[model samples]
Target: MNHFKQTVALKDVKCFALHGYYPEEQLTGNHFIVDLETEFSPIGFDDELGQTVNYEDLNSIILEEMKITQKLLETVLKNIISKVIRLYPFVEKIDVSIKKLNPPMPGQIGHSFVKLTYTPTN
Candidate 1:
């Protein structure tokens, strides 16, 4: 069901990391981006950073997860989901998107990506 209405998001978080199916692609890494959307408990009068999730911390988690080599993008995304859940339990829903800017595919293929949306149970 539904819970929260407000959202905290981070978009176009770019980084270079080792994640690919082939050894060459993994070794020479490529530009990668991770976008996030999270819905947490509504903030009251506290107005403190801790009251809501931190964008930088989320980026760091995404970057750290991307560094691990994986043959499939889903694996990377799964890692992020688990980490985020552990970090921010109040978050009711989350959307994490991972994009490989320069995929090693054929010519003209701009990028490849996997985006996952999650809604935790209360």
Candidate 2:
């Protein structure tokens, strides 16, 4: 029997962080939503924690990265992806998206976001 690929996802993870180009934006902080998906080789029918990526670990990484101040969402996304890759070297692919809520702008703009997909080269 052929086993399909496996994926673990952490979706709609909410966070409040101070990340922006402007100093005031960092000082004041803002709301953010994070979404992540990680794909790895299939782990057959074994029900073991070590067999699959842990969602809690992913959440912790997201929260930890969010606390750091960065001028660009792209930077934050990269940082998160790098950390995850470091922890799970077996990870084959990663998809991440970060949304900044209620951005400071003259006109009405709900949010701005950065989304990235990464595949490790071996």
Candidate 3:
């Protein structure tokens, strides 16, 4: 049997966090935007909740990671990817992008982001 993959994109997830390289950044939190895409085998296409990935669970994981982990966006992104792969074993690949709005850059108003892609090993 041949297995097909499905891609799901969760974009523009607004979060408030204090993840940065500078010391003062830790004290001052800023807005963040997260976009995630998870690729997995399609088990079913029914409209029922159980037929597909539970976004509620996914969102919870993302929120929990953002709240507890106060480090670089890269670390946070990697953490999220690890958690997702663990929780959803059927997932084959994933792409995560995290953006910081109103950052403490020299002249830019705000906007620092990172993107990561991962493929789990069998």
Top candidate (lDDT): 2
Q: What is the C-alpha lDDT of each candidate?
A: 0.83, 0.93, 0.83
Deviation from native of the Cα of residue 121 in model 2, angstroms: 2.2
| Residue-level lDDT tens digits of model 2 in 1-122 | 77578899999999999999999999999999999999998665688888888999999999999999999999999999999999888889999999899999888888898999999776
lDDT of 3 by residue, 13-104 (tens): 89988777887888888889998889888888777766666777778878988896466898999899998888788888889999889788
Cα displacement (Å) at residue 53, model 2 = 0.5
Whose TM-score is greatest here? 2
Worst 10 residues of 1 by lDDT: 40-49
Compose the digit string of candidate 1's lDDT tens values, residues 1-122. Answer: 65556788889988888788888987888888888889877765377887788888888888788778887788888888889889988788889888898698779877888999898655
Error of 2 at 100 (Å): 0.4
TM-score of each: 0.87, 0.94, 0.87
lDDT of model 2 at residue 76? 95
What lDDT score goes with residue 89 in model 2?
86
Per-residue error at 48 for model 3, in Å? Answer: 4.0
User: What's the residue-level lDDT of 106 in candidate 1?
Assistant: 75
**Pairs in clash, predicted candidate 3:** none
